[model samples]
Structure formats: structure tokens, C-alpha cells
Target: MKKAKTISLNVGIALALFAVFLVPAASATTVSIGSTIVGEGETGVVSLMVNDVTDLGGVHVNLTYDASVVNVTALTNSDFDSKPNLYKRGHGWVLLEGGQYESGLSGSVKLCDVTLEAVGKAGESSYLNLTDIDIETFTYPPTDIPIDEVINGTFTIKPVTPSAKVVINEFEQNPPGDDSGNEWIELYNNDSTSVNIGGWKLINSGGKVVTIPDDTVIAVHGYWVANWTNGSLEDSNEYITLYNATGTEIDNTLTAADGNNDERCWARYPNGIDTDSDNDWKYQTSTMGETNGVPVAPVDTTPPTTNVTAPPTLWPGKPDETTIPSGTPLPWTSEPVQLWFFRTDNSDSGTGVAYTNLSLASESVADLVNVTISNNTWTWETNLSKGKNTTVPGTVGEYFNVTISEECNATIEYYSVDKNETPRVEPKKNLTVRIRFEIPFSEVTPGTRYTANVTHDLIEPANEGKDATIVFFAETATIDSKPYYVLDINKSVGGTEMYVGINETAENFTMKRLVMKNKTGKIMDLTFNPEYTMLNYPLWVGKTWTSTINVSGTVTYANNTTIPINIITTEIEAKVTGEENLTTPYGELRCLVVETNAGILDTGLSKPITITAKYWISADEKAMIPKYQSYINGNLTEELVLK
Candidate 1:
């Protein structure tokens, strides 16, 4: 199955309510966060549930929560919604809404999930009152009229229970990502009934503590979770301790997990069972706020034998090229072309292949490139004599966000990325997938596209130049106070192309080594740029910002001899000019127009002489990204509209 979209702290909520197509008749759809019963000083997630929702295209959820009482931290899609999150919070009200250009979700969907911090006074009452709700449909002829329904959630805040019997159930100091936002801890309530836990504190090994907020409650024998970057545990030899309102100890001396768990988190099996020993806690795939899920150990102990290769480009290439140097950037072709790629995975792990998926990026297609995605996995079943394929018509948009299995094929059509997902595989077995597709040239100015990224699942070294999750350019987000973006940097090695990944873990894009080709068509490692800034967010009208960038990387020709990377300093400046009512496949929206003049930055060496772009930003606060973009560099580069 395709991996779910990941949201980093850098890119806020604008992308949260992403592009999930919904189709249903709105028989008055009421939306609300389930009874808001949070405890003061506690951090938890609230759900935006829909009751009696049919053929739901999109929803605009606006609600007010006493800012003094609770603060929203992040948003996640409920079982019913699948798209990058599309919601915003400001002025005490959150505006949550999203729809797909070609699809819709059906009845009784958990529209979205809200992660918030309860920061109210004990016994202070606050309401997560649904102020106004608008459910719109974009079926052929658009429906400007909104759907109405009974709100599904209730709002109620309670004070802390001084004698509550909540204990630290399971915790993970580190899980994954830039190594910061992955830690979490679960609390189990052994009491007879739900207990309010506001104004409590969870202390770390360093003695630092964060207070629990109001509205947090644990039902009889239920569980609650504190999982966010701000509330993360230390990924070291630290300990976790829980304290009540009066500083009474609840749970303590719990060891923290190390900093490298991916897909796995520390959990307790045999619910509520504690031995005060490491054996009491086992590391397994995280279950978050639910019962201790099926225990499975981390699979990183042995790296899978992976080889991802792309056909030669410049001219379109075939799918069977085995040598690495066969693929090279055409750098000048702009017309449409067919792309074919292959991947093979072999492992010694017992769960040979539980499941796997692929995600493609928007950059992989032209402005209006149209194509079909067929599922060939079922055909292989017959080759293995398993019978036949799913036989369903293929669709790109439908498969855009899910994993393809025996019963389902690729439904992706629009969106960026075809990331890979994994499944439990048998030991010493290899499973391979070879996919090929046709993409029209990135039709733009100069009548041809200059730079092309051969689409793949990931952009890292071990996998050659493939990127399952293109972090660098996935989406734009707001971090501390500034906005940032992740970009995949491509390099040529052995006359072939290779890719590298960059993440701002150290608060900047930390590039340490450069992998390139030497003259003998061999890969060479060299020193590269360190932490640096690539882009910014929070751009407002009449606001101009400048950033100095150092362009540095080694250059190698067909000859084995290579020159050390050159370091050049360049200045970049950008400004927002006006607003635009941008139109997309979803609908029309008001956007911002930001003009930039940085020619050098375009080449990663010098500033651009004349760079103009209309970043059609929405009038909405969380619409930080341009819904429609028209950019002009030395040549007409890109013109795109969000679907």
C-alpha cells in the first residue's frame, strides 16, 4: 500500500487538509470535535468527525477554542480523509476544509484529527464550539450552496483529578524523521472511570517538565498519548516521570528509548502490565493512542539489498538497462517522453514483504500531462499461477494515496510522489517491481524543459538517485518563525545520475559528502556544502527578504580527474506584490503574488538577473503555498496550478 503523506513541522497545516476527492450527497453534514474533555496541561488529539455525510466534496470547519485553554499544534487525517491536510488556525478560530479535484469521501468519516495542548486553569470551563460549518460539493457544476448536518462532537473541559490512577504505559524517546518530532508516550488509566488530568506534569531526565492542559481525559481502562516535537522525550539514557497537580508522583523511573527507531516505538504488551524492568517494555511498531498493537521488532538491523535504476535519458531510454551510467540528464529536452524504471528488494528478515508502495511527485508530470495507471501485480499472480489481475480499470488519481495489492492496483493520477512502502517479507527472498510510464515533456517556456528529475521512490545515496519521499521539495512549511523547504539535489556519477537528500535537522540543510562520477565512470565521494538556507516562508505583501547562499560542489567529467568543488556567494531577494483569485482543479481561491529577482540562485552558483513569479497565495492564513504559480526566469521555466 502507498505510504500515508507525512507532514513536517516546517510545512504547517495548509497541506494538512490535502487533496482527497469526496463524492456523496450532503444530507446535512454536521462536523465537530468529539466531546472536548481535556485535562489542563495535557497534550492530546481531538477528532473532527462527520455524521450522516454523503458524497462529501469539501468542508469548511470553523470553530473557536479558548486560546487560554487549548492551543492546536498539528492536524492529521482521520480514516475517512486522505490528502495533505488543508486547515488553518488564527484569531481563535480554525478553518478546516479540503476536497479532491476528482474524488470525494463518503458517509460517517472522521474528517480530520487535531493535536492540541491543554493550557487552561483547573476547573475552568471552555467550549470547542463549532461556530460555522460549510460543506460544499464540486460535482460537475459546482455547488456554491453548503451542506448542513448535526455536529458530531461536544465540548467540555474538566479540571485535574488529584488522585487519578494514570500510569506511564509506553514511551519512545526517538522514532524517526529529522530525529526531533518522533518521540511519544502513552498513559494508561487503571481507574474505574474517566479521570480529568489537567495541570499535571511529565518530567524528563533533565528535570524539564511541561504541564498538561485541560480537556484531557482517560476513559475506564483507556489510554491517552503525548506525542509531538514540543512534547518529545529525550533520545538518550534518560527517564520519564509523571506528576500530578500537587506534585504527587504518579509514574517514574521509566527509561527512554534510543534515537533511531523507525516504524517502531516502545510499547507494553499485556495491557497495563508493568514490571519496572526493560522486559516490561518492548520496542515495536507504534500504536499511538490505542491498545498495545501487535509487537514487531525494528527491521533496520540488516539493510535490505536494494538496487534502483533508471533508463538512459537525454533521449528516452529502455527499461532493462543494467549498468548505472546508462541514465544521464538530457538537460535540454522539453517535449513529452516516456520514463521507465526498475526496483529490486531482497531481505533476510522473516517478514519478507508484508507490503510496499510508491509515491510520485508533481514535478514528474507536465502541467497537463494525462495518463493511465494500471496494476500489473495481479498479472504476476498468473505467472506464479495465482490466477489473474484485479481486472479493474486503472486510474492515476484514485491510486494516488494508497498501496497497490492483490485486490487493488495503482489509482494515482495526480499529486507528487510515488513513494515505496514495505511489507513483511520472507527471509532470503527477493521481490522486484518494474514500472514504466509515459510523461509529456514539462511543457514550459523555451518550448522545452531544461532540468528533469527521473522519478523514483526516494532520493538518497544507498538507493542510487531514487527518492521514495522527496523531502527537499515535498512542500513548503513554517518552522520556528521562518518558512523552509526541502529539495532533492541530483548529481552525475560515472556518466550516470545519482541523488542525495537534505534535511534541516541542525536547523539547516546539512550536506556533508558529495557523491559523483569520476572520469573512469566510477562513483567518487567529495566534500560538499554544509548547513544552508534554500527558501523561506511567512512571506507577506510588501515584505522583502534577502538570503546569501554559498554554491559549492565538485564537478567531474568523463575523465577520472576531478576538480574540487567551487564555493561562490550569491544574494537572493524576493517581494510580494499583490493578491490573485487563483483557480485550480479544486476551485477558485484568492492568492498572493510574490516577485523574486535572483538569477544566480537558479543555477545554484549566482543570483538570477531577472526572476519573476506570481505565487497566487490564498487570502487564508494557512494558505502559505501558492495555489497557482507562473514563473519566468531566463527562460519560461514552470507554470503550474494545484489540483
Candidate 2:
């Protein structure tokens, strides 16, 4: 699939709502120090939870203890949401193991009565088995990485047996981009002693060997995980096999087996990321442990919350005004809202306030852009508020003040970027400038005609009553209308030369003619400059040339405005040679690629030099072919636009 377009608009929005505050909290001791001693069989469940009532989003708890003496049995549901509650029922476990575990194993255990247990007697130099804890927790050894605080869940553990020890954590698949190709696996150290997975091996279903870094280790009270990077070999829909240092297969996740998006996991910890076996590999929700035909259900009993605050305020700026140009529609609107009306200057003795003050109602504005935008009418009600009878001011300097307000919340709706306006420049007069072709597109080969639209302030010039003549000139001179020119020249079927059909206008009062030249001198052409004559000279119009020609002359009008008009001439080199290749757009034809080092052309890779024989078909099918185009990096820079 193609990547979504990332359009970056560098517009800054001043937020006036939600604010974030971080307050220093007094340190609280989680575990009663010196109360714990070392040894095994000293079964004890120590659970600590943080409950900030005012913050329903939940809070965090910091527990410190002697790892040598106490074993962390489990943690129940450790993810956070908007609710505040503690659960005694957990669905998973993490045990001390030699390697990672498969997430899809189904010998299930219930989680309602899950609890942390230390099974040894006191005063004995016993070890604490950190059981059923989150495999990716930073509280474990080498705790430098920051944990994602946005997640909340619980943890728990059980006594170590001689049987297999497996801890599993699953990551859900996100699609399109970073969502896909991202995965995780959790491993728990359910024993008192921290286990090192330095020489562990990770393999896939295809029996292919995989490499894992030797520095990886799972702390006594924590878990370990595997996150695939950009270059890792991962099955789009296959299983992953995990092995120990001795090349013994410890765990394997079956992909593509139970259909698409199925469970490829086995769990020791309950209430993990996903609960559905095929969709998410969460531990069984009922029984938690297997103890000599007896089922021991363990649960996590900790709760956490988050605190949030409101944002800052914004102050409105003073308004300004300006005169509406004549013929322009009065009472202009400022974008999505706020109608603008011109008023006489009541301030500074009729000099008028530089702008109008229309204190728009907050209901009439918006802070973000939305799809329901139209002309600046705030609402149907306020739109009717306009068109009211204008009062005839009794005084000369008195202003209309155009009362402006909104019937709806405008400021929160129609939010706009506030760019300070600069002072306007007055109009100039009696100046005539004749623009000629500095360069033509044909001179650049793989280029085309330059078309541009122009708009003028008709009211400003009309108010000044300045009678002026505006003309558009090509290579040829013309009368009142814009001048025209023939850019393409080719041999016609009638044995005559061809010319462009469009005409352009000129700017001078005198008339003249242009001459053409070529080194071969086989045919005469046009020159850039024509012999200039006064306005009284005989003016020639409607004349045609049969051979090579150049267009250059002077023009006149009733306004008497004048300027010199010149002919523009240039040469281009297109050395097309070679048989054309077949394409979907253009069929087979001859073409050639000519390399150039003249200017900013790319010389890195071979560039295309496509050419085609274009036939204008009157009835039969036309033969069309590809043309040359200039590209930079992988983007089109210029191309020949055939008319």
C-alpha cells in the first residue's frame, strides 16, 4: 500500500484549555524495611497499591525491597484507564526460567485467588522468588529505560516447581505503518536469583536460525522481551520458535496456523495485552497454579491513577479599519466569520481609525479548522443581523460603527492566523513598461509554454481616472488587442511554412518590421529588432509571409501611450536518434538520450531522451510517442507539454 501523504502546515495554535501540571510529591515507603529476611519456603504475598482519589486516571507506586530475601509472586491487571478499582483476580504468571516461553500454550489456570507467596521459614538464609511480574518492567536490574506510564495492569507469582517454567506476554498487531511489523515477547524470572539469557537463540517456523544479542538478561523480579527492528526477518503470517543457549527449543509461537490473526502464544502471566486466545495470548481467567493436584489461583491487588489540569487564557487584540475601494462589494468578511464594514474616522478629527472595530462574539469564532465552512456568515440569525438600515450620521466625523456580534460561539469555532498587516502603498501613474520575452520555453527543450493569470485593482485605478493602455506582447506586434507570435515552424503538406495561430499586442506608437537570419541563409527569418518609424509613418497590418519570418514592430492606440516592442529569438538543440521503445501510453517509435553537462542537469544516472512521431489524424488513428522530460532525484522537474 502507498504511504499516506504527510502534509506539514507550520501553523501554531494557542491552546486555551487543558494544562499539564507536575507537582513534587513526598516520597512514600512501599515496603517496611528490615522486616524481610532471606530464604526459600518463606511464602508471603506483599502487595502495594497507590490510590489518588482526586485523580480517577490513576497513579503509580514505587516499591523497594531486598531482592535477596523476598520473592515477587505476581502483579494483577497493570494497565490504566479512567476508572479506579483493585482486582483480586488475575489471569497469568511469570516464573524463573532458562529461556523465553511460547504464548499459545493452553494448559490453563484460573486467576481469582492469585496471591504472592514466599514458602520458606523466617531466620533461614532463604532466597525470594520474584514470580509472575511484568517481563518488561524497569524496576528490574539495569533499570534505566523509561516504562510506558500510559499502560496499567497487575502482576502475581507462584512457588517454583521442578516442572517447566514459562512466562508469556503478547503484543497486538497494528497495521499500515509502525502499527505492523511491531511485536513483543515477555519472559519472567520467577526465581530469587536473576537469570541471564546471554546466549539464547530465537528461531522461526521455517526452521531458519535467528540471532539474539548476548547482553540480554531477565532480572529476578522482572521480564524480558523481543522487539523486531526494521531489518529483522519476520514472518508476515508465520510462527516464531524460541530456543535456549543449548539449542533446546523452549517456546514457539505458531503463526498462519489457526487462520489469520490467531494466537501463537503460551502464558505464565495472566491478564496480558490480549484476552482472546487467537487474537491475544492472555492467561486463563480461572485457575492460576498447579500444586500437587491442587489449583492455586493468584490475583494482583494494586491500583494506580493520573492527574490532569486546564490550559492558559488568551487576550484579544485591538481592531483596525480601512476604506473599501469603490466598486468593490462593501462590508467584507474576515474569513469564516466576522463581517467587516467601513466607517468614517471618528478618532483624530476625521482622519479615521486605521481599521474598524468589530468585537466579534466568542460564539462566532472557532479555534480549529473544520469541514462546515462557507462565506464568513456566523449563522443564519447573525447573517440577518446585517443589512439593517444605516443611520445617517448628524456629524461629519461620526462613523457607522457597524455593530458586529455573533449568535453562536465564534472564537471557539472560526479560529484564524493573526498576521500583522503592513501599511498599504499608494498607486503610481503615467509609467509605461513594455515587457518582452527574456527567454522562451522552446530554448529549454523539455519545457513548455508559460501561462499566468493577472488581476488588477480596478477600483483604485478607476478612482484616479488614469486613462492607460495595457497590452500583452508575444514576439509579434499588434493593434489594440494583445500581440501574437508563431513559435513552432514546420514544413506543411501544401509546401509552405507553418506559423502559430495565437496573436499578442504591443506598446509603442510607431510601426516597423523585423528581419530573419540563419548561418545557412537557405531561408530568411526574423530579427529581434525592427527599423523604428514615427507614429505618422505608414502602418502595415494583415500581412502574411510564406517563408522563414521574424516579427517585430511598433503599435499605436487612442490613448497615445507608447513603448518600444522587440522580437524575441532563440535556438534549441534536439538531436533525436534511435528506435522508440514500446510503452502503455506511446507505442513503438524512434528516440535518443543526449547527455548534457551544461547546467544543473543530473548526470548521476542515465536520463531519458524520449521522442515520438505525432500524427494529427483526420479520420484514422494517430501515432503518438513519448517525449523527453527532465527529472531530479525521483521527481519530475520539467517536461514537454505538447499543445
Candidate 3:
């Protein structure tokens, strides 16, 4: 029985040993490095992570990469409690090992982080490969932990491209007179930032290459011209190509016939426009250093014809009458008097009237006018024939005394009559008046037709009978398939006459162009692309709109200095602020207040400028006028107010 029992115990122990051997070990761990992208010359970090680790007490990792693409900059152990026991780096590989001093770590953890710098050219890539990795568990005798997966990372270098765009703008393959010494190519920088084009090459189809000189730079929205005196361009079928400093093709023109000396050349219509197709090039009049467009012939010199069509010989209380009689005297009233004139320029299929200017010549009384003053107010009363006098009563101690007298003309004087009072006069309040009586008329220029509507108030109430004559010129034009009556107002400032062109439409009013002519005959024409909108129809408060304006043209100064104005894009935001009664030179009328803010991208300036303009628009009169304008640039401010 004892032998049998001992044999049974041995069998039980054998079964127990088999059961211990059947137990499963821990799960496999995973080591990996994630992929990353970095720009050339930029730095990036890659983490060496471990997952599903069990009793991980020590670790050894080795990584390799393409040295030409990226270089390891730093290596730091993260998961271990103590510093790495061994850390080393070579040309293309790195090795690190570390261990925990107190207890073994379980579960997932970060082993190390490797920082690298992208050193290769754009589009190059490198591999982060792991090799010779070992992980051990904390025990009396350390045991190796099995790795089920190894994830490698990839590092890529991305290209860096400039934001400024440059393109071939215009070219003249054939000269109007001679081919040699005239063949030229033009390049334009279309962005607001300047670009360096040094070492750029221009290649013709005939194997001729013109290399741009060193240090060549193009300004913002500016041009660079290359003249080939040797006639490198072919007059027949040919194309030109542009290459940057690194031999990369930047732009190319389509294969087409040359200008053939037709006084025209290939140019981008809006200037600096390039779609890499034929639609961008146009064969038109050569605007070498100006905006591209068809050339305009000289304007006809014939003056328009004008005729008075309002005011009848019979005195009527109505102000809008077209006729009274042939020679009736104007009524003596404080109400505004209306003057109307019909103008036409149909002769010779005339180029519409350009502008109109109406002048208030003189107000004359047929009999002597006497003035009487009372309580700081004055009145005119006729006494003697062919003589006039005006007076303004002064406050005893505050205001200066104003007086005027004339036999047939008027002379004004200011003085103080009270000895105890020191007369005070405002700067703009001191007035001088000189009047001539005879009707004077002179024809300054010839025209075809003219039409105008003017209203004036004769408030002086001098002699009862007064005669006044109105003189003006009017013109018309068609723009963008729309009929526009062009009214030009020339404001002279510092030897420069600024012509503001207002194009009135039935629905709204806009400004089409601005011409600044100096006394030296040099002119600068600034055209608003898409016509700047001054007012919009259905005017109401809180109405808002936005527009983008491109201003382009040429400027010539009085000193003969010329500047080619490249395309300047401005963003405009407009809103109807409110409505108010506006008092203008014409009269007091209800007007809608429109405020506009314009952000202009000015070339050669570090930042964009802002121009704020406020306008008063009379819906009933169909008049839009600027009330105030302010411009703010870097360190500069300008403000203008209409008086």
C-alpha cells in the first residue's frame, strides 16, 4: 500500500509540472516611430514608443536614417526612471539604452524622442529604421520580451515657394522702323512685393539667349525691359521662353507671328495678366510704359453749339418755365432762378461733349439802389438811377462795419465807426466786391452742342430790375454700352489742374477717370477699372456693398518725370450711414450719407493704405457729391473737405 501511495504522489507531481509548463507568457510588445514632414531647413521630432509592454525594466534601441536627407539633432530618454546608460550617435545611426532603478514599467510608454533637421533639397525623403532592439523584464534573471511589430517612420522635406509672382508681360519682336536696336522684351512683377530676377534667362526659338545681369531686381508691380540690339527675335513663327535663376521655366509665350512692324506689339490686356495661353496676349497699340489698350485718335477740335432755352419775356412766378418772352426782365424775388440751355455736337459724328462749365457773370440793377441799416441788418432801396450802394450795420462793440458804393460798379470797404470799440473781423468774412455792368460774351473754344440746368438765388434784393446772363459748355460720351453725359470739373492745386470726370447714369453715379495736367502740359491719366461707384440706386439707410477697384495708368509730372502706374487693387466697402438735409452751393436738399472705406494695395509700400470718403447724394436732384475725404498711409494723413 505504501509503494502504491508513493507512486500516486509522483504522478500527481508530474501532472503539476505539466500544468505549470502549459501556462501562457505575456503578450508581445510593439516599438514604433511615427512619420513626419518638415520643410527644408526646418526641424522636427520623432518619438520612439512602446505598446503592450510587460515588466519592461530595460530597453535598447538602434535607429538608422538617410544622412543626406535629415540629420539627428538630439536624443532624449523619456520612460526610464534614470538617465540612459549608453547613448551614442554616428553619421547615419543612433543607439540608446536605459533602465529603471526601482521597479519595472508595464503597459505602454515612450522610450525616447529623436529630434532631426531636414537637410536635403525639396521633395527629398528619408527613412527612420529601427534595428537591434532589445527589451527585458525585471526579475532575478532578466528575460527578453518578444516584439510582435516594428513600425518605421518616414521624414520628408517640403518645398518652399515664394508668394510673389512674376511673368512676361509684353514683347516687341518687330520694330516699327528698324528691327535692330529696338527688339525688346518686358517682364512685370505682378505682386505687391518686389522680386529679384538676377541671372534669369530669356531664350528665343532661334537658340538665342539673353541672360539678365547680376543684381537685377524688379520693383513691386513694376517692369523690366531687355533690349536686344542684335535682333535676336524672329519676325516669322516663333516663341519666347523665360527661365528663372535655377533654370526652371517660369513662363512662355505661344507660337505666333510677330507684330510685323505694324506699330503694335503683343501685350497683356490688363497688364501682368498671364494664364499661360493665347487669351492673355493681344496685338494692339504699343503702350510700352503704360496701361495696355487700343490707341485713341486725337479728339476733334470743333466746339459744341449752345442756345438759351429757358426764361420767357413775360415774368412768371414759376422757376421751371422754358420761355416767357424774348427780352423780359427777371423778377425780383428771393426764390432760386432756373437757367436751361440746349447743346448738341452731332456735326461730323462728333465725339460727345466732354464737360460743361457755367459761370455767374454779373448782377446789374437798371436804377440806383440805396441801402439802409437797422439793428445789424441792411436793406436795398432804389433812389438814384444808374447808381448802387450796399451796407451792413455793425454791433457797437463787436463787429466791423461793412460798406459798398458804386456808380455803375461796386467797391467794398471795411472800417470801424465807433471810437470806443476795437473792430473784430473774421479772416474769411472780409469781402471785396467788383462788379461790371455791360453784358460781356466771348467764345473760348468751338463745340457742337451744350445743355445744362442751373439754379441760383439773387438774395441781395438790390434795385428791382436786374439782368443776368449764363454761359456754359456741355458734352456727352458713351462708355461700356451706356450713354453718359460727361461733366468735368477742373480744380487747380499747386500748378496742377485735376479733372474729375463724373459719369451720371439713371440708376447711379460713378467716376470713370481722373486727369491731372500740370502747367507744363504734362498729363497723368488715372482710370478706374470697372468705374468707381459713387452712389447706388434704391438709396436707403443701412444698405451696404463691396467692390474691388483696380487703378492703373501713367503719370507725368511738371518736371517731365514720368511714372508707369501698374495695377493697384483696392477693396472698397460702402454703406449708407443715414439721411440728413445737406446745404450745398446749389441749395439745401435732403441727401443720403454714404461712407466708403478703401484699402489700397500700394506698390513699394510695406502695408496697404486706407482712404475714407463720405458722400452726400440727393435722390431728387440725382446728384452725388463728396462731402469729406481722408487718406491714411504709413506716417501720413491727408484730409479734404468740400466748402
Candidate 4:
């Protein structure tokens, strides 16, 4: 049986050895934990002591504190050092330096809180221990407390501009901008409240005043009223003066009416005190309204739009006569000019129309413009740049957006259309059309199947104030086809020559003769010279050598005997045996003796005879397969036979 260890709560704590004074009524005792404050680069001292304990035997105690929960800074003096050894123990902490103890006396341990000169790593917490180590019956509080939450406060701010002014002067225009037929005024909201500028009037030197409605509220700490009339008259260069609801002059531009300089100001009441000024905006060296005497930005102000009608200069018919105002300018060019072609047709199926206005190199057409067609469910714009080569997702029959943009002129034209089938451009008739290409493949591989689909549509564009075009889909005629394989080999030995059968086959079930070439640059058989069939031939697979030979050149056999084969029609591979640069040919090249019923040298044999000889290979064949012979068109072209 294991004996329980005794815990050291208080050195003098003992279980009533003499029964002092009637055992003072067994009352509950409580313990409390506290922390000490340490300055920057300073140390903190802590103590753990126990009192009023009746018994302290048969208890094992340990204290643990997480150092990370508390900040431990470098001490100013070397004397102040925090070695975890002094207090930290196995999952707990212990008090160090127990001085002389007195019977029934209070016991205390000292600890030093480190001073932090600089901020330590963020998102960390340190802890202290006040827990009971071995006494399970004596409950103790936890020591791990969040230290990161006990940090200091911080402050931050946004940026501001210089030359932005705050003043009170007369104004010719609400916002000061270009005076040449264009006018604008800027206001900065320096406060943190949304200010109401309703009933505020923009007064001019000529006594003309424009009222700002109640909706004229500027956002807090931002610019507002970039231009007068909610910025509509921004382009109109007119002198402006500002007035409050009481018709009093609160702010105005200088007499010069140059619409420049720091002569602009904003006031609370008409002529009331200015709460904030461009020259006094807080938290910045410069102002928020101006940057180097130039306007930084227009206020986030929204102005009403006005429609102005202008007469057309020239027209096809009605020359010197007035026509309807529905037609837009002719030759729309890069702008999003409305296009409408109407023809009285009672037919249910609309006319087929095809028109090419831009090429693949053109910019996006539907960027800023929208087209709508009446009685049509789709709109379309074709502005695909070959450089982008964008691909649309979904099947060819799905609905998609077609956009065209003209970079030369800042304009974008777009439409939406559903293309379920191909669209045709027919004879003379009014029809709406939309086209977008939907390629099924992201990229084209050599022998991979891919479909390039062109979606088409026709619709009306004048009914719904939007561009609408129907869509139809069609795909290319041919998909992907396999590559053709041909094996050409030629070889000559001394004066005798033998030609391997040539074979060329296509994946489309077409077959032809495989061509032959030699070292002497001769099309047929010539002098036997090596080095013509190097890497150009496929001889090695992976790092290993497969039996593949090319009959392009001549091969010298033993006894001065040689055979020239034009093409070796054999399914063999040239593979690398070892790192010694030796190529070994392996596989069956000829029919079995029983299958042929004649001999391996049968002249009319479909399978070629397998020959092995080093000198019988082409010169280029050695360099081609670094470790093996040549394997071309999935067939053996050359083989080296051992003498």
C-alpha cells in the first residue's frame, strides 16, 4: 500500500495537538488570489500563504501558472530575473525562499512580475497558480487567466488633404470648377453627424438662388455637394453663393469668381459659426477637401438628370423636313447608340438575320450599353477578343450574356439571349440577332475531341426599352481526329541490299506505304552510312529500352554479308537496358513458323523478320535513343544482331 504524501500549506499548521480553547466552532475559511501592478521594464512580487489550518498532513500540493498569460518584459536591473525554475514545476508552481517559520505563524512566498519595455507577441495570455496540488478534498481556484485582455488603449485615423480651405465668401457657382460652361462646388463634412442641407439655397451675385431640398444630407466625415443642383449643373460654369434656410449668406466664393483657391467654407446656420474648417480638420496635417490646391474628390452627391432634345443635322429622307425623334445618330460607331429596324410582318416566325459588325480583336461591346428587343426573349452582343479566348459554361442550349466593347471609343454593348439552335441571316427583312460562341473545351490538345459552338438568335429591340435577341446554337462540322503513323527505314550492306516492308496507316482506316531514307540523302537505298537516324526515332520507353528498329540505313552482318531493308513493319520497341548506353530490341517481329507454314524469310510475309546487329543500325539511331535502338511509328525500324 502507498502512503499519502503530506502537503506543506502552512509550516506551523497542525491538527490541534493540545486542543486550544474549545476548538473554535469549525467555521468555513475562504482564500483569495490577487495580482500586482508592474511598470514598464519592472518586476512584480507575489506571495502565497495559508492561515487558520487545523490539519495539513497526508496531502500532496502543487501550484501551476501559465507564463504566457502574463507579460514578461526585460528587467531594467540584472538583479530582477524570472527563472521558471524558481516558481514553475511540473504542471504547477511553488513558492521559493521560505524564511524562518514560527509556530502558528503566517507563511509567505515572494514572486517578481516582469516589466515589459516593448510590446511582446500579440494574442497570448499568461497565468499564475493558486491551485491545490495534492489535496483533492481541499478545493483550490484555477490560475490561468486571460493576460492579452489586460492591455492598454490605442487610437487611429484616416488620411486628409492639403489646400482644402474653410472660409466665408461670395460664390458665383455652388462648386468651384472650370468656368468655361462647366461649374461645380465641393462641400466637406468634417463632423461625425449626417448634416441636413435641406432648404439651403445657393445664392449668386445676381440675386438668383437655388434651393437644396431636405434630401440634401451629407454623410458624416465625408465630402458632399460636389456640384450644385445635385451635381447636374456641375459642367455649367456659373458663380455661386451659399445661403442657409433663413436666407442668410453662410458661405460664398470671392468677388473674382475664379472658382479657385481656399475661399470656400461651410457653416451650420446662415452666417453662423463654422464648426469645422478645411484648415482645421483633426488628425491630419492637411485638409480633406484639397490636395496641393487641386480638388481631391467630388462629394458623394447625387444630382437629378435632365433630358435635352437636339435636332438632327442630316437624314436619309426628310431633308429640310422634320422626322420622328425616335431614330438615333447614324453610324453608331463605338457609342451605345440605339439600333431599331422595324418591318410590318405578320408571320409568327421572325426573319433570320446575320450581321458582322466587329471582329475577334474588337473590345467588349456590351460594357456600358444594353439592348432590348420586343417579342424576343434574349439579347446578345459579340465582343470576343482572340487574346482572351474566354469560354462560357453550360450546354450550347443555355442562356448567356453577349457583350461587345470598343476600346478606341469608350463604349460597351451587351445583350442576353438563349441559343438552342443555329441562327441564319436571311434575305431582306427586319430581324433582331444575337450571337455568342460557346466552346466546350478550355484548351485544345493534339488528339482531344473539342466542340466550338456558335449560338444565334433573332428578336425585336424597340418594345421594352431594352435590347433583346433570340439565341440559336450550332457546332462545328468536325471534332478531333487521331494522328497518322508511318514508319520509314532504309539500310544497305556492302553491295547487297534488302528493303523492309513500309506501312502507313491512319486512324480513319486508311493505309499507305511508309517512305524510306538513307545517309547519302538518297530517297531509295544508297551507301550504308550511320548517324542519320538518331533521336528522330523512338527507341526508348521511359528509362528502359524496348526492341524497335528502323530500316532507314544499311546494316553490316558477320561474314561481310549485308541486307538492305527499306521498311521494317514490325511491332517492336528499342529500350535502354542499363546505364551503359546499350539499346536492346525486344518483341516479336515475325509470324510463328507454324502460322507462316513456310519460313521466317517468307517474301510475302505481313510480319517482318527480327534482325539484331550493332553495325546494321543507322548512324542517327545511336544518338536518337541514348540507350537503345530506334522505334518509330510504334514499329521497329532498326535492330543490331550480335556477331
Best-performing candidate as measured by TM-score: 3
Kindly indicate the candidate among 1 and 3 with the higher TM-score. 3
Q: After superposition, how far is residue 512 of candidate 2 from its true place, in Å?
A: 99
CA shift at 330, candidate 2, in angstroms?
99
Write candidate 2's Cα lDDT for 559-622 as tens digits. Answer: 4333233443222122212223333233443232322111111232133212111111111012
Candidate with maximal lDDT = 3
Q: Which lDDT values do the candidates have, in the order given?
A: 0.47, 0.28, 0.57, 0.29
lDDT of 4 at 595: 6
lDDT of 4: 0.29
Candidate 1 similarity to native, TM-score: 0.22
Q: List RMSD in Å for every model shown.
A: 32.7, 34.5, 41.5, 29.9
In angstroms, what RMSD does candidate 3 have relative to the true structure? Answer: 41.5
lDDT (0-100) at residue 482 of candidate 3?
Answer: 53
Per-residue accuracy of model 3 over 99-161 as CA lDDT, tens digit each = 888899888878878788998998888768776577888775899888899998999998654
Task: Give each model a TM-score.
Answer: 0.22, 0.18, 0.26, 0.18
Q: How would you encode candidate 1's per-residue C-alpha lDDT over 1-643 as one tens digit per residue?
A: 1233444542445444442224333366566576566676777777877666556676755555556666667778755343325244443445566665666667676767777777767776444655445565647664744445455443345655545478887776766675566566788997878888888888888777767887687799898887644555667677888998888987864465566757676677766666666677766777777787544554533322222333355234545444323222322322233233222234333222112222322322222223232233311111111111111111111221112222111122211111123432213221222222211111111111123232221112233333222122343434334443323233332222212233334221222332433334433333323323222334345656655555454443334445443565655566666656755443565555765554333243233334343445443432323332223344543333342
Q: Which tens-of-lDDT digit does each residue in 1-643 have in candidate 4? A: 1222234423235544445655666443223234554433334544333323322221222233333234333212211122222332221123222211122112121222223221212333233433322211212231221111111111111122323332332122323444433344445544456667778777555565557777687666445543343333321333456677777765654333232333343222222124444332211122223431323442322211111121233233544323224213232222232333222111234221111111122343322323322113323332333222222211111222232232222222211111112332112111112222111111112222211111111111122122211111111111123223222221231111221111222111111122223332323232111111111122211222222233333332323334555543232222222222233342222110000000123243334444331222122211221111223223343332211
Those runs of model 4 whose alpha carbons end farther than 4 Å from true positions after fitting are: 1-160, 167-202, 208-239, 242-498, 503-643
Q: What is candidate 3's CA lDDT for residue 430?
A: 15
Instruction: Report the C-alpha displacement of residue 643, candidate 4, in angstroms.
Output: 10
C-alpha lDDT of candidate 1 relative to the true structure: 0.47
